[model samples]
Target: MAKVSVDRPVAPSAHPPPSRIGLVGFTTMFVIGTDTFLVAPLLPDLTRSFGVSTEVSGWMVSGYALGYALLALVAGPLSDRRDRRRVLLSGLLAFSAATALCGCATGFWSMVAFRFLAGAAAAFVSPQIWASIPALVPPGRIVRTMGLATAGLSTAQCAGIPLGGWLATVSWRLSFWTVGAVALVVWLVLLRMFPSVPAAPGAAGGLRATPRLYAAILGRRRLALFLLGYFVFQAGNLGSFSFVGTWLTRDFGLSTGSLSAAMVALGAGNVGGSLLTGRVAGRFGPRRALLLGLAVSVALFCALPFAPNLATALVLLSLIVGGVGFMFPVVMTLLQQEAGDARGTVASLANAVMYGGTTVGAALCGLLITGLDGFYGVAGFTVVTLLTSTAVFAASGLFRADPATA
Candidate 1:
């Protein structure tokens, strides 16, 4: 049996101490999630504040996604060739500023502009986290650490939105301010705790391979269908949360408290799902776990529209969010293994696809809800997208461990 080598060159530590790195990653994810979902509970208030329709108010959510999607393509390569810590810190600082700016903006359009900038800035951190993880931990421990990191995000999603909603009730502007404050803390922690790791010397040359890389990523027969399917799958999971708070307000006359509670449920589900995936993926194989997640998510999301009451809605939402949590961690694990030594570059590219899906899901849902008459249309669209994504993932045979690893 070929044993794994203990003498392999150690990957440079971009994150400082294990505990500090985990703390920074956790805080970063917490604030980012808060910023991203903060607008959900406040969408109605935004609509009222700016005197815009639900569609226009949605810019608060969708606009950020647009920024994230556009910048993702470049963020990865830039992280590979530069100091990832600096890149992450700069992004967090910018996001912090943008979130604070969101508070001071008097009008809706101004808020949208700031949200977009914040989104673009926030995009930098996620890919950096992904790139840094393999470097920070031993290979055998990578999956578990990633799980913990994912849990941080899940906790943020579960707790942040409701807290944001409650804050918004005090002052919608306060929600943004809160996000900024959290981001500032995260930036400080990262600066103080995370070590500086320089980019690979010839990493710039990797940028020259951009076209080939793009083609390789997009055109690979084994990966193409999976990527496409995953894109749609993410769209479904994301799109529901993008507008669900608004639906609750419009459909069931829910209060801020009730809406916040529902958001909490969603976040809890995310955490639960991620934890479950971490335990199960290795046992079942990443592909099987992913397929299972997508299948369950589709069913849960489809059932959301017909939920009879707030209780039912929250229960269904838990299932949907948990499914998302379970699915993505597995996908990320698969992606890392697939990328091999060029993990940073590969991570960046994968991030680009993920954010692209986010942009599409948010925008597409916004368009559908705004263009159509009701929330049902939006829900139906989410179902279709998820189903399509599931089918796509199922058709592709990428779930098996790469033969190279074998």
Candidate 2:
């Protein structure tokens, strides 16, 4: 029996610098990230356009998450056996086309179908970026590079939603078209600037071998616990977030402009957390940083429902999102490290878990919101999930010693 080698060829030092690659990756992710959350603010417009209730209209959001989750399991492993650059470029091209079709959708079902396709395309794109980061940089800079990539995501959350909301005021279709156009431009830039990232030499078995790889990785108790913890955490975080537009409009009667402004504040908190995540993880260690973020999130989730006005709600919600911003980079870095040579498969599965949680949470929120005290019910659900995640994290034993200082 031959021992499988775990090593892959690193990026050439003389080619595209890591900083340039990081910037391109960040831009690509920013477009993808913006598309993910852009729909939140457009829920009202969609409801009006489709002549459906907000609860039913919410399925469009869930559709994207569901598609992304299912396809990611396949995409990750497939990328591990092919050229990552080709996979990424192909995904980006499909994403742009799907997004444009979404903008042209004439009804609810059509919109949902296009959104799902868009997400499926994106499933192939994002994991490549995550897998490439580890290959593109030295071990010491991986977390920092991850931080930059995550920051792109956070910045999109902060700025893209507001931009989308502003565009939706003119026409909901405009937002989708805008996103599609940006994606096309980014695809071109990436095609020109991105370096080739070959698949791991020993990971050529593709989909047939993915299940065994996942089984082996999940056999590690600590890694399994970490993934489970992330699932629970995202369920709580996204459950409440998915309904913010409805809550704001129905409860406070805020217009699109006002809602966009409020979301900008929330996004700013995320940006701050993303930018600081590397330093935070380095200083306190990933375990402590994750725990602290969860604690902050739980406290904020509990307090958000009590806010007397929109101003108070925005502040509390921003802080809660900030906790999410802080947690993502740390957890992602840990997951990537655990994957060894199977980075693409691991990263994709991790993303799948995250979005799978979103799908469940968003669908559940849709059901809950149909009842009285819907927003409060959602908030309660968030707190419970956060607490559960905290418990799982504590019990995982991954934090027995700080990874940074060890």
Candidate 3:
């Protein structure tokens, strides 16, 4: 029932290697993620440059995120109607332009406008990769290829955060300029190497049709359940993750340098796991592998509070992030499969929920971190949420391939 890609897609070859599409996917995710992390390190400089209170400066972060999250709903249905290749290129061009414009901003609101545009443009780019992958790759390779894309974000957390800080030392504008330049290079490569992918056979995409399309998609009973499960999955994962730095500083008395080093170690584990977890998919299938990873995360969280030393805590954190890496591709693949031809719609929804989960998680954990005696509140809350999400997935009955048989 799925439409074959023909007009233009990420790759055009009859039997293109997964790595080729994955390469562009990785680069796209990395560029967007780096931009996301870049603003945090540059915040102080941004405040001084814009002559705003620290609180007002936080709008730069929220403004970018608002564009990214809100526009995804619109971009999704639009990508579903056209050649994703063109859509991706246009998004890249717009994203690149807006990123560069951030360097030229004369005042606070102009900078926010540029960042919002950059984020909105970015919303269009990633959905194309996620949507086109199934049509572009061998069936067996879907989850594996998604893992390669997932690696991009972990890599950004590891490398780009510090790079942004270092660039900020010279000038915050340099950070945007650097990422924008890299994005331009990526756009060129994708333009040359990518091929055409057409819309789903029967989809009628128009601004007017957007509401009907979403109404139909959301009307599906199983998919709605699946999306709910994914939301909770992210809520627990991100909630626990958001607190790691605070936990380290409080429990270990680690300074900024030591905390960064510890975070890098955990991030490295995430990157490694993201790159390698495809093998787990090959062996156990995506659903089983993901459940296995979640179980491991639950165990890790359970043990983390009891860790007696910095080394022990770091080891546990690394494994936990690695488990997250192991889980990501599988969950994404399942969500895409549930999407059927609505890959773009589902991908955008996924991103939206991911941000929502992080926001809600961080907010809730703020209270838990302060309320319940050391890190136990965070640990206990995370464990309960993980288990609850796992239960949701189990009850949804979506994993029909069954880990039992695999």
All candidates: TM-score: 0.90, 0.95, 0.81
lDDT for 127 in candidate 2 is 92
Each prediction's Cα lDDT score?
A: 0.73, 0.83, 0.75
Residue-pair clashes per prediction, in order, are 3, 0, 6
Q: Across residues 157-265, which tens digit of lDDT does each residue of candidate 3 receive?
A: 6777557656666777888898899889999999898877777566674678877777777787878877777777766677556556666766677654455566577
In candidate 1, list every pair of residues with a backbone clash: 16-194, 16-195, 158-267
Clash pairs, candidate 3, are: 8-195, 8-196, 8-197, 9-195, 9-196, 9-197
lDDT of 2 by residue, 149-227 (tens): 8888998989988998999889889999999999999999999988787765664463567677667778878888988
Candidate that beats the other on lDDT, 1 or 3, i.e. the better one: 3
Query: Whose lDDT is greatest here?
Result: 2
Of the pair 1 and 2, which is ahead by TM-score?
A: 2
Off by over 4 Å in 2: 1-7, 404-406
lDDT of 1 by residue, 28-90 (tens): 777887787788788888888889877556677777877887777767656766777788888
Model 1 lDDT on a 0 to 1 scale = 0.73
Instruction: Give the RMSD in angstroms, all C-alphas superposed, for model 2.
Output: 2.0
Compare candidates 1 and 2 on lDDT and give the better one: 2
User: Highest TM-score among the candidates is held by which one?
Assistant: 2
